[model samples]
Target: MKVLFLQPPMGGWVTWGKHIAINVNHAQLAANLREWYPNIDVHVLDCRALEIDENTMIKILKDIDPNLVYMGDALQTTGVAAIHPRYKRAADLIKSNLPNTKICVGGFFYGANAQNILEETESFDFIIAGETEATMPELAKELSKGDPNISVVKGLTYRDNGSVKMTDYRPLIKNLDELPLPAYDLFPMDKYVGFNYVKKYVETYHSRGCPNGCLFCVGWSNYDKRGKNDWTKYRIRSGKRVVDELEILVKKYGAKFVCIMDEDFNVYRPRVEEFIDEMNKRNLNVPFFFMGRAPYHLRDKDLLKPLREIGFVCGLIGLEAVDEETLKKLHKNVQVDQVAEVVNLFRENNIMSVTTWMVGYPDDDESKIKNRFERIDAIDPDMMALQIMTPLPGIPMYDELKPFIQEWNLEKWDFQHAVINTKHLSREDLGRLAAWANREFYSKPGRIQRILYDKNYHPLCKLIARCYVETADKHAQAAMKNEVFV
Candidate 1:
């Protein structure tokens, strides 16, 4: 049996000058399939990196001529709502050329509503309804046995005599350690790029799932789609296992930095301690970074020094908003003071902090927007990600904002641009406010010079810091031109 996996072209996520990333989930899927079915041939085609059009992709599919082709829709790609058009175009072309081949897709996007996805797109033969690690291997074995009636297979949605039907939900993988390290070999690792902070850093995961019920996030919803309503089911790999992967990335792949793409890294203190200790023992000199809740870092303050000693150079934190009322509405469980403290703490530890904030909430007016920017300026994170509040589907705000969504274009849904307006601000006005916030925050006297000349940052970081201002200027220019306001 032969199987193929594809990362579809990033519809609009990168066309607007955003970073292009390797689909780590697809790499994991390839690893899962290859581990389970050693005799079955497995291959991956990253259309996004290759910049191949639908016709070229169709040709690649024809040349490979696999029995099954799998595609995925991950949250990092701004959900399938943005990529569905590209997905359908590729699926249709594949079906037209290879009618006998089976097509399957899985990831946060289809896993949310598998039945509806299948009903809407006949190009797909099946959809994996949950995490594919457990489901894909089992489905492969069943298909090898020639079992046409795969309703017995859990975590699948498929067409049945012209009607859509879904199988039972698959349980979440409780033991993340059981899964093999991602098949980074299957991807064009050198082509991957990130923001100025972690540019070209290799990706790995120490944990999965987030406990926070932030209204604007879809991480928890992904677990909910699998029927695991408990958000606290945040799982982690053993610290030793994580260190082993880190060693592999550094020694084998020559990774200068590793980015743990977890939803939140500071969920469990003891696990972090173990990781720090293991990394120290291994003397893994590679600089790395991770993301987590802002308050969690302060609560685990003792771990900061050790984390820094273990070559932790940068951290990504989501402050969301600075006002108490907005934080409460979003259920961020973090305070404005906590946000300020976290920034100061990272700075004190000599670690670069990239803080994120959102604008265009329901009650937000021009005054509130300006106030938010004022708060961010006061806090003064090393880097800032000012985003417009988008009503991405599956989040609680989606239903409320659906009625008012001004632009139906999926490409506009990337967090960098706003697709909806606040009660007082138009979409164009929101864009202007966002652009102004970027300019004002970075325009602090000597801020750019300090970052560039600071001896604390990694040499690679300094290289990026020198050029980041130009990137920010480009974004600001686009906003001023109102190019992305629509």
Candidate 2:
């Protein structure tokens, strides 16, 4: 039996610094299959990394003709949301061309809404509800026997007797160290693109789950039927384990820069300290970046200089909103003061900070929106990502705003477009304001000049700052023109 993990062509997004990156989750699943089910032939077909087109992708899929085709994304909500549309397109092509081949879909996108998605389209044969590492190998093993009982496979969803069916939820891995590292060798490591210099710039998942129950976020299995443990607790890999992977990425793969793609990289300050210690012992001097809550910076304020000394160049702050009332309603659990402090602290230490916010809440008005702009400006983060508040399926925000949701098209739920209008503002008004807010920040000559000439910034960091500024300019223009906000 042969299994292929396909990252379809015409797929992927430039959401991160406007650069398309390799999905490490793909390598993780492929590695687990190779390690646990060595009898089966495993292959990866990443049209995204190879820059293949639809015609060529069709040709290659037919050539490989794997018995099982898998479609999944990075094990995060935002990552899957950004790429789910492409996966649907790819699965349609696969189903049409290779009608006999079995198709399986995983990741937060398909798994959370497995029943609806399965009912809507016949493209995906099975969906994994939670994690795929343990489930995928077992699934492949069953299929190889030629008489498979998919119902018995935990965390799996499939069609049954003309109705959609889902099995029991899969339990979260208690210890992350038990899993194999991502199979980077199986991917086109050289072709992976990043916002930084064209060296091997890759990202990794050192941990899973976040306990912070922000209503607007899909973090911590909030939208899936994941086990109870996942809903309340967070799990992490050991400092030693994290360093081991980083060492491999930097030395073995020649990675000059890396991004820690964890939702809460600073969930535990001690883990970061241990990571720094191991990084030094291994002499792994690769510069890296991470994004997380603002309070974590206060916890590690003393370690800022040491982190910088050992190649920590930047950290993205999840500043969802600067208004207290809005923050309370969203359960962001972050204070505006903390955001201002974190931005200033990172600036003093020469580490760049990028803060993100969501506009177009149901009660928002022009005055409130303008107030947010002033608040963000006061904090003065190196960059800002002011996106419209897009309500997605299976989340509290989505359910709450269902009546007000004007755009039912799933593809536009990528967080870049204005889908819902506020009580006092129209969707058109939100788009225009979003455009103005984006231009208002990036158009600042002082900001761009300060970053371009900052002596402490890494050359690649400077380049990334410029990239986002330009991307924001283009996106803003698209919004004003009533085109796709991406």
Candidate 3:
């Protein structure tokens, strides 16, 4: 009946924005299991948050001695398929130590390709495919009983008779309000921070799935069914429910700042209105962050005033690419002009616009890469995430990029590392350009002064600026050292 959610030693490049985070997915899975199956003892050992070493983790594992261990990270931990290698190694270590404890893996990346994960690793006993809130507790109930007739469980993947077996895809949870609140008491809430600086901060999700089916995004591919439904579906909690979590995080946990690490927010206009109204009603105007599309902000211009009025300090809405042709190739339904328009809009409202841009497309050369930088720089976002175009293992562009992929290490699947070469550039070339762009952008003249003295910049936004620069330096340093470059 004892279950452990184990996040192995994760830091360095594995961290998001060089800050440690509570594995929200781990917390949610354990919470749901405890709520539905109270007898099942759930414990979380988040090494990322605890900042433990291998020796310390092994010692703690022995102390806990859990019967079942879960390995998965949500959006916050940058828990894409890139972390698979680390989690797989940790699973092997657990098996060698316990010799009898069961292990399961799921998340935005591994779960989408569950059958392959089980086929490749003997260490993992189950894969909770798709949205795990419902499947996890059901599997836990069976595991607690000592006899797992796993075939009966839907949205699960396992090994059967020496072959990989996958149950039918579970239906999406349309009503997110039905789920119980996360078991925050189980987490070391005090240890988490945002932008690597905000002590009184938390990262959470208000919705699941993004309708924007960008080809290079593994997170979006997880929700897509790849059929007539195309974009498939997205499920979001009511505005009241989202505000309820914010209230608890602020009033109860004393959180001064929060990050809505949803894959994308502001998809549905009504839900956003509800969220704003509830926050106003509760008077919980603690500064916060969220991610959404450039077009959504433009479409919902009316909401910007209220959004700023209620402590919306920063947001991560990616520009993706600048040129129209590149945008079309990347499947971003945005005009070349909307990129700057949205950034200007957020700036006018005093919301720090944290946007993203990608380099290393199939036809990119030094000229194209430089053009990307010149374009995004002109957009004047408060923070820009300059990423090497990483085409991850199961994303829509993976197969097409497979032939060009020079690196097979799952650990390097993060966008920070270039895995595939374009027609005009090598992997090393892409990394070097990324390194150059990162240095050039962050070191722009008077950027620090603007962040430090600009009245428009929110205090938390300044923290985000500092965190972004530090993290960018780490990435740029790695590329310069050839640690990540070819």
* Best by the lDDT measure: 3
Question: TM-scores, in order shown?
Answer: 0.91, 0.95, 0.95
Task: Point out where model 1 deviates above 4 Å.
Answer: 11-18, 51-55, 73-81, 196-200, 224-232, 463-468, 473-486
Ranking by lDDT: 3, 2, 1
Off by over 4 Å in 2: 75-82, 196-199, 220-223, 229-232, 482-486
Alpha-carbon runs more than 4 Å astray in model 3: 12-16, 76-79, 221-231, 482-486
Give the winner by lDDT: 1 or 2.
Answer: 2
lDDT of 3 by residue, 286-308 (tens): 99888888788888999998998
Q: Which has the better TM-score: candidate 1, or candidate 3?
A: 3
Q: How well is each residue in 85-126 modelled by candidate 1, as lDDT tens digits? A: 666767888899999888887766566667777888989998
What is the Cα-based TM-score of model 1? Answer: 0.91
Q: Positional deviation of 447 in candidate 2, in angstroms?
A: 0.4
